[model samples]
Target: MSDSSPLPPVRLHPEAELARDALSTPLLSRAARLARWAGPDTRVDAGGGLVDEQLPAAAELLGLTGDAAAAHAAEAWRVAVDTGLVEVTDEEAGTVAAGEDLPLLTGGSPHDILAVWLAALEAVLADATVPDLDDLAEAMDESGEIDFSRLDWDPESEAAFLDGVLGNLYLLTVTEDGPGDGPVPLPALAASMIVPGDLGEPTNDMLEQISDAMMRLDDQFRLLEPIGLVAYQPVDEALMGDPEEEPAAPLDETDVSRYGMVRLTPLGLYGLRARLLEAGFGAPAVGDLVDKGADALLDGSSGYGPLAARAETQQWLDRREPLAAARELLAAARGSDEGAPLRRLRCQQALSLVGAQAEPAVRDVLDDPELGGLARVWLSELGAADVPPPSADLVYWLTIDTLAAQLAAEGNSEELQTLLEGLAQQHSGFFAAAWRVGHPATADVLEAMGRLHPDKRIAKEARKAAFKARSQQGG
Candidate 1:
């Protein structure tokens, strides 16, 4: 008998560090019980998500009821999936089993349950809740053009879409609820989702967007909260006014508006960040940059989105003594090769933060070619030296480096294949040359593309470049 099975994921897991706090222990235990009750071969209906068959049992087990009982039931089932208790699958596909190796919850240790959930969570996240998140993450590698209009609203990508909506919620939260911060009001979170406040005052249109966002939130929470990805106070049906029967035909409406507050559970954060990190995106918080050297700091910040990079850059600078920071900045800038000019400029910006103390280093580098223009500009800004016209190559290198950083940080292989192909179209010969360039992480990044790309030809090309780089280094 011949049994053909696909290989397990290699690079994505083992790097995932699941966090189990006091609150998560019980949820994880319940999740384990849910999985155990379902058995190892729980079968989902053929044409839908795993929630269909398990909701009632899950809802009852979780002691959930009310107008939101079904949602809670679905969420608990999802938690069982996310926490490694229940695996989502089609009974007919035989590709996956809804109950693969899941143990019954009777006296199951928290550590063991958490361990199982961690492994399953990585797999689920690897196969993103948002199916086209591959393309979406790739789009972020550049101007981050999100064609929200094209998002698949089907159950498959609903979770991933929810993750994006959550991001908008997260941005609204940072000031008040920075990483590891607590919950914000549901109204505020939903409002932020509709109008990020980017365009000044909110308008009526935003209300519609908020309502839409809430509907989506309701859908997500029904499946997510029971499993514990989110914790919130469900909408109080009692708050609404009694139905007004008028002389005219009455309007029938079901108020699905959600309220109270919601935030990612510790487990949710770990799972999402793991997906981002695996795809080469920057998911680190500001604290990760504290105490790092200027070069390392800039390198780390390079992959972060504009807002986070700026915040992280400030935090990095704030931690250092001015004179010492300036010296380190200049040293880092001087070390930047043509391969990474943006890093040099970022270092220069950090130097400027050091005030007049940075003047001496600027003076010392004034005679150097690659850095002289920047040096003179910093000095000139302070009325100490003449500013030279900016160097063309410096600007060019910066542009390319910026693109490379974004590409490496966020572009998945499909995007990588296109980006590399586009670069090849522009440069006379690029794939071969890319490995030689000073862009940090190029070789490793290319290797990741090689492994994940959908097209064999592009995958082979990426592999070739990675090999060439390694060979050149060894030589």
Candidate 2:
């Protein structure tokens, strides 16, 4: 697939796209490069894929490490196979590289490779056998020296039980965290598998069974870790039965989430996104614009919250010339919409980013009573021709609106406090007069200022102004 592959119908928040750019794309690129370096026949015998042999070379290329513990060759191979940059084929006895595998000689789109990786994950799961789980479970049982209860799920075939672990692993891994950055703790992952989702509370027996199963299920990691699909950081070994060693206590839910915070690797994040979308969960895109017009971009952004709106709008603005952006923004502000006042306010703020060239269009709006306050402020900020002072109510509304814009745009608490101090200095009875300002947002703006101001005295004054405005409205 190419970048032209249709994404989910709904546009997601910008953060989702940003995470992939910052994490996933880079990981895929590195994996592609590493795979090519490892060559076409990158064969892996039952002895863990011959990954260790290539570690020094791959590590040098990726800048990870060539040394035994630091080597990430295993992880590189996992990424390569998952991303389809490197192909792993079945041999008569073990796994071998497919002869026709084409290396991703150049960088491919993250979205394209992510789809391939996800398809592969589903394919492997659909075809995986019970023997796969049994081989891992046997190894885990030998290490289970701690007290644990076997699960009541008695399957005549251990294969079914093994498959359950894999299913539980996949489900738990997907639900664990967002843009999951850390590896998950095996105990926590195992406990989630045992915890009945329908039960309001599980019994103590279930908890014990889950704990033991989690330890036994450590075999999941034992199998997956070698392929570099997962990794672990053991906190401490249970120094049980040794008088000199402190006794290790059973892990509780709090200890489980606290001690071992498992995160997915970038590769895992890529694969899991596919799983999430398949489950009908909405995956976010950073800057998928529904419309490119200034109004559409500005209006479209409001639903995404402040940071996203700013990011979304800035991205839209960056693509167009400043003069064009200013004109479109001004026209969007003049739309016959339900939220005209708010739109006008937002438009003026966006114009500031377009700079002085926007002054003439902004000046033309000064005659409109609703936008008069904002236009005057825009002119002043640009140091244009001298403008007569606005009326006291207009002044009150304009100052409050300006502060509100700052609160939304700049978010400077100190600047807000300073503005309040200036109002106090300029007008001895600022709050008393502010209570009766003639703008629609007067009360709301004052109320927000009061609620958000850090200074107790200023916040009190703002609250007083808001109360008076409310009383006036009621009367």
Each prediction's whole-model lDDT (CA): 0.55, 0.55
Local accuracy of candidate 1 as per-residue lDDT tens digits, 41-113: 4555543234455666666776777876766455445555655455555456522344544643333465554
Q: Estimate the TM-score for candidate 2.
A: 0.51
Candidate 1 lDDT score at position 41: 49
For model 1, the run of ten residues with the poorest summed lDDT:
1-10
Per-candidate TM equals: 0.42, 0.51
lDDT of 1: 0.55
Candidate 1 total steric clashes:
5
Residue 180, model 2: Cα distance from true site in angstroms? 19
lDDT for each residue of candidate 2 in 1-475, tens digit (9 for 90 to 100): 1123322222232334533543333344555565556545455656434545655666667777435423345554555665465555554444545222232132435454345445444433332322333444554555664212433233344444444554344444433232224455655565666676687877899888766665445534443333233454543345113657656675343555433334444454444455545555554343666346767666554434444455566667778877777777877776333455556667766777778877777777777666777788888888888765787778776776565555554455676667766766678787888878765556776787687667688789989889888888773
